[model samples]
Target: MDRDDETSSTPPAPAAPARASRSRQLRLAALLLLLVVVVAATVRVVVATGPPTWDELRERAGLTNRDRLIIGVKDDQPGVAQKLENGAFEGFDIDIAYMIAEDLGFDAPEVTLLSIESEDRARRQARDADGSFVTVDLVVASYSITEQRRDQGVTFSFPYLETEQSVLTLASDPRQVASLRDLERAKVCTLGTSTSEQRLREAGANPIGRNRISQCIQALYDGEVDAVTTDAAILAGFVGPRPPGELPPATKLLRPKELRHWDIGAESAEKWGVNTGPVPEMRDLVNLSLQQSAKGPDGDRWKAAFDRYLASEQQYSNPQQVAVGRQPEPEETVEVRQWPWERWALPSPGRPRSGVPSAARAPSRRNRRSSGC
Candidate 1:
């Protein structure tokens, strides 16, 4: 035992401070690790429960993985919905389908149009040229929204057009059909599964059910039916100026003079809605698109369609029979939650002006302009 042994025996000059420093380092490391874990968990939760994205919405509504957005539309109805010779679809309903498809992230080429008859509208089924039953993502076939139809499993979006039921006869026909009673005991052609049939039955008229409005018109042309009854907007379509040879020689005879307005109650006004099948998400998404179209900043797309397709015929039509000119308000409100960063997307607030109350500085309350059905 020499000096080295004596120094060792002294316990290395009190190492408590170094031991305490090491303990603090270990604790700090543990604290940092815990903070990182907490941060990671918080990020995971925010991402999981965050606001929905458009892609997420599309996926949830089952639009993803599909090659195209298949929309069911009438192959013929003149102004309301129709297929063109170029294998493309045109007319108001087709325009509406395009608008909805655009909002749903599909281009014109990405949309496949299949002809859908009135009876098959609620079932969300359409037919290709080959007559194969094709499933469609939406039906924009001048579908009228009704409680009975809703109960029957047809989920409707917001009503896009409002037109009253009316009767159309050949211009050569001299009979005045101002009311349903006028059609009593007469064979009136109407689309099957349409409100027109029920209404005709109510009026003690014989409703000749057809698969399409074109069929009804054809029946009238063939003298197999006395009159064709449906939404005035639809009748206006055929009455409007058509390309030469667009209609049958007989259907070309439908003139404004022969159109009769019932001028009935709310039950007679057909509020056309997009059939979104049974998916509530799809319904809500379509409703959102309609809401935007009806209330967007620039103007109403619905009005544009109406003006382009049905407005001209209004002068010849009974003023009361024309659809309520403006687009109807959406039935449901859509709440799109914003992401945390979206707050930054908005303009940043400046400092409050001197002596101005917060409420006074806020946007003034302005009554929304009145709109009809």
Candidate 2:
């Protein structure tokens, strides 16, 4: 074969360095993808998990029976929940809070109520006054348990009370905008990032978002917004159906006369979600309380709380349209981890590890011994 023909027939071999570089690039790309997946999975798990266990939190705070649990509560909400003129907290939520604490072995006086605006309820389990990483042990501020909220790292106990979405407008408004549709280009006010805000957006209304329900109330009273919308029970608390504190402004609900139901926030009906941080065990305890609160010598804690606060609220439906009533204890018992320096049983003796490790796994150093010579 001629030299030219031989050269064309045997094409040049790719450079070794180039091949190695291409292989390294592929491996790096794979590693990057794997890292992204791992991080995303970790984030999802963390978001789903509740705050520290109740015992752990108690220990961290050096809490005792003498140490009152700082509970997050809404002060502006009237009969449903509010700080009274006498400086004591009142309402249905306040009663529920005391009941939960009582179930956890704390007396009513052993609990402390922290005034929380509706907007700050989501952050109930957050930093404390000392700039310490702490959150409220329980949140009872008309907080709802929704899939959207659950996705946002807010852990909720089972529902204790149910409410419906409704609208609130000035009693003297010329527009008389009552229903959701009544709000055309008219501005509506609500706590920012709330279910009510989302629903209003969906309902095609101009929303005047505020940081707190107090702000929303002020906006409604000032006519900056034509109406304020939220849970019917909340609306009931606002209007004089059942007053919370001194009436802020005269407000009335806009509802269809035929349908006693109005589902805002795409909520089937509003239900109270006792919020905690990533305290899974606390959640379990709270759920157990719900189960047994109506069963024992405590005289059915829930019924007691209902009689104390909810019974008088004129807005709640008759006998209540409850999705949950007198929850029964789980057939299986949960481990009562009452201390921080304790461990929970793993699903299997040798299972793959997950979640962010609290510490790095140390390599074992074996000591070698020489037999006698």
- Per-model C-alpha RMSD: 11.1, 23.0
| Candidate that scores best on TM-score | 1
Q: What tens-digit string does per-residue lDDT give for candidate 2 at 1-373?
A: 9999998999687799999999999999999999999989976775457344445544543443445677887766655566544466556677677766655556665666777656567788434546554467778788877888889888888777776666666655555443576676779887776677777777789887876665666666665777777776655544433323332322232331211222333346677778865766667666655655544344355664455444444434332221233332343443333222233332111112232121221111111110000
Model 1, residue 17: C-alpha shift (Å) = 26
CA shift of 203, model 2, Å: 1.3
Off by over 4 Å in 1: 1-51, 243-267, 340-373
lDDT tens per residue, model 1, 1-373 = 8999888788456888999999999999999999999999987886688645555666789988876889998767766665554455556787788777767767666778888777788788887868899889999988888999888887889898888887777778777776888889999988888888888898999988887777777667678888888887777655433333332221233312333334434354689999998877787678777877777532455676667666655655554456777888877667544455753563111111122122321122121110000
lDDT of 1: 0.69
Candidate 2 residue runs with Cα over 4 Å from true position: 1-66, 125-134, 174-179, 241-267, 294-299, 315-373
TM-score of each: 0.73, 0.59
Look at candidate 2 and give me any clashing residue pairs: 50-277, 50-278, 50-279, 51-277, 51-278, 51-279, 78-244, 79-244, 126-135
